[model samples]
Target: MKIAIAGAGALGSRFGFMLQQAGNDVTLIDGWKDHVEAIRRNGLNVTINDKTFNVKIPTKYPSEVTADMKMDLIIVFTKSMQLDDMLQNIQAIITDQTSILCLLNGIGHEDIIEKYASKQNIFLGNTMWTASLVGPGHTQSFGDGSISLQNLVDGHASEAKYLAACLSEAGLNAEYTDNIHYSIYRKACVNGTMNGLCTLLDADMAAVGATRMAHKIVTTIVNEFAAVAKHENIDLDTNEIIEHVESCYDPKTIGHHYPSMHQDLIKNHRYTEIDYINGAISRKGQKYGIATPYCDFLTELIHCKEDIVLKNDPVIN
Candidate 1:
């Protein structure tokens, strides 16, 4: 399969390297000049299981993108705020046969893709893998993971299976799921609770679990999210959800990892998917008459702080 990874940051670079190693033709597309230049000069450095390996693949800046090369699949891993512009940048390469899969962590991305790509060629997926860009052209792999995917509401089963098989052939653990929406929400809940708290408290995954109040705070957020999930006709167990969140902190698991929200806030970026995660819960809570004061306050606080930071010192252009 000829694959193009749009937004080749940490996760995208990792996937591109792994797929390329599995003998699939992969190209990485990004606007980060340093990363693209470094990868072009010396291959992408992938660190997994405390070891580093170099994988050579073509990398290109967005401005260099052309329509000459046909892509069977394009994985969208851009930050939620960057998705629209990323889609616009890739218009020349997308065709009727192109499959665009979004592995981003938020709601409303499907609508954005539907506006640009044909519904028949779009797929939605959720991933549990954690990654970070340790430096330019260097990606740190934090955990062993799998992917769960499905076609959009207006899609066909055959397409989902075909795409899943392609990813599986590329050595990515991919599977078709009937309940991808629930899976998305489940992950959202986990991130909403863990990511925000870790960022606000300056804690690592394991350290977050070590504190006495950590479990209670996560329980509060997850239970509130479960209330919203129930209204959407999805059944979830709070205990099971707690276990899933706790597993992230296990020493044997991805223990030393810091959540993306933590990294974003440290970089003083204006956007965080708090609006999609906790903000989504708070929005649904209003409709169901469920009070999610914790999520509400946290979402508002972060937004206000980010607004101040961006206003004072706008992101480097």
Candidate 2:
């Protein structure tokens, strides 16, 4: 299978390495000039569970794609806000036979991707994988994660199943799910809470969980998501979701790790996907007549944090 890892950052690189390991023809599509050059010069440098290695995969800039590059599958890992731009930039490679599996964090990516690919060729999913981009062309990947995905339309179930099977052969822990929305929301709860709170406090999951107000704050934020999910007919169980989220705080899991948002906003001074996570929930809450005070506040604070960091650096976009 010829697959393209769109937005080849940390997690995308990890997926590319795994798929290549399974002997698939893999191409990495990214915009970071330094990172792309590093890979082109010296293969992708990756460390998994303390073991370091390199994988040689073809890399491409979206604009530099060739006419012969029609992809069989495109696994999108672009950041939420940049999805549309990445699609437009890579439009030449996407053909009618191409199936898009969006593994982006947060919500509403299917809406954006629909503008590029037909609904029948689109799939929505989420993953529990974790990785950190150490530098250009280098990534440190750790932890275990699974992917759950579903087709947007029933007519495409066979293609979605084949995609899932192919990914599982690469040891990605991929599963075709009938209720992908629930799985996505389940993962989003983790991002919405751990990613946002950790970035703001400059703490890891354990530190946030150690605080006395953890439950109250988590519940407050989760209630807002649940309310919004209800409007979508997902019927989220707030208490169960809260427990699943708090589990990230356990040291045996991801307790001591700062999430991707922290890596983006604090360490790298890049803008985060707050508008897609907590901020998305907050907006949906308003549309659904649900009060999302916590999400609204968290969104404001994250944006404020972004502004402060950008003001100090004034170079990042």
Candidate 3:
């Protein structure tokens, strides 16, 4: 399979390296100049379970993509805000048969991708995989993860299955899902609660859970998300979701981990996906005449932090 990992940051580099390791012809596309250069020179440094391998996969700057380049699949891992620009930059490689899969954290990403790729050729997926950027061309991944995917257009079931198989072949456990919208919402809920709170409080999941009022705060935020999701016909179980979310607080689970938003805003000094997560809920709440004070307030707080960070130490990449 000819694959492209668009927005080749931490998670992107991990998948690209693995696909290449599995003998698939994979190219990584990113806006980060240093990362592209690093991979072009020394290949992508991937360390899994403390085992490191420098897999040589071709890396390209999005602007470097030409009409001659074609891909069977393009997995998008860009930040929510950068999704549009990345799609525009890599339009040349998207042919009629090309499948664009978005594994971005948050919701409402497929709407933006539809402008660049046909709905029938698009796939929606979410993963439990985690990756950390060690440097420009290196990534550290831990444990195991699974992918849930479904075609946006129903007629392409065979094609969707093939793409899922491709991911599985690369050791990325991929499963075809019937209700990808629900999966997307489920994944977004995790980010909305854990990632946002982690970034805002400048703490890990355990620290957040340790607070006496953690359940109240978390329930407040998730209820807002649930109210908005209800308007869209997604009957999210607030209690079930709350239980699932709070499980991250266990030290044995993911309690020590700071989420992607923390990596983006707090550590990297980059803007976060707050608007896509809580902000999206807030916006939808207003649209549907629902009150979402928690989501609204969290969105503002995260943006304020992003502004403060950007003013202090702006990120270059």
List the candidates' TM-scores in order: 0.93, 0.97, 0.95
Overall local distance difference test of candidate 3:
0.87
lDDT of each model, Cα atoms only? Answer: 0.84, 0.90, 0.87
Sort all candidates by lDDT, best to worst.
2, 3, 1
**Distance from true location, Cα of 227 in model 1, Å:** 1.7
Report the alpha-carbon TM-score of model 1 versus the true structure: 0.93
- On TM-score, the leading prediction is 2
Poorly placed runs, candidate 1 (over 4 Å): 267-270, 287-289, 304-317
**Stronger candidate by TM-score (1 vs 2):** 2
Task: Please give the TM-score that candidate 3 achieves against the real structure.
Answer: 0.95
Can you give the lDDT of residue 274 in candidate 1? 86
Better of 2 and 3 by TM-score: 2
What residue runs in model 2 are displaced by over 4 Å at the alpha carbon?
Answer: none
Q: Which candidate model has the greater lDDT, 2 or 3?
A: 2
Q: Report the lDDT tens digits of candidate 1 across residue range 1-317.
A: 88999989888998998889888899999988888999999889999878999878899877777988778899998878888898888878898889999999866689889877899888999888888778889989865898999998554878899888888876789999999888888888778878888777778889988999988988998888888888889887789888899888887878678887876765535367788788978988998999999899889977776666566564433
Best candidate (score: lDDT): 2
- The sequence of per-residue lDDT tens digits that candidate 2 reaches over residues 1-317 is 99999999989999999999999899999988988999999999999888988978899998898769989999999889889999999888899899999999898889899999989999999998888888889888767888999999887778788889999999999999988999888888889899999999999999999999988899888888888998999988888989999988988767877899998888877889999999889889888888989899999999999888898685664
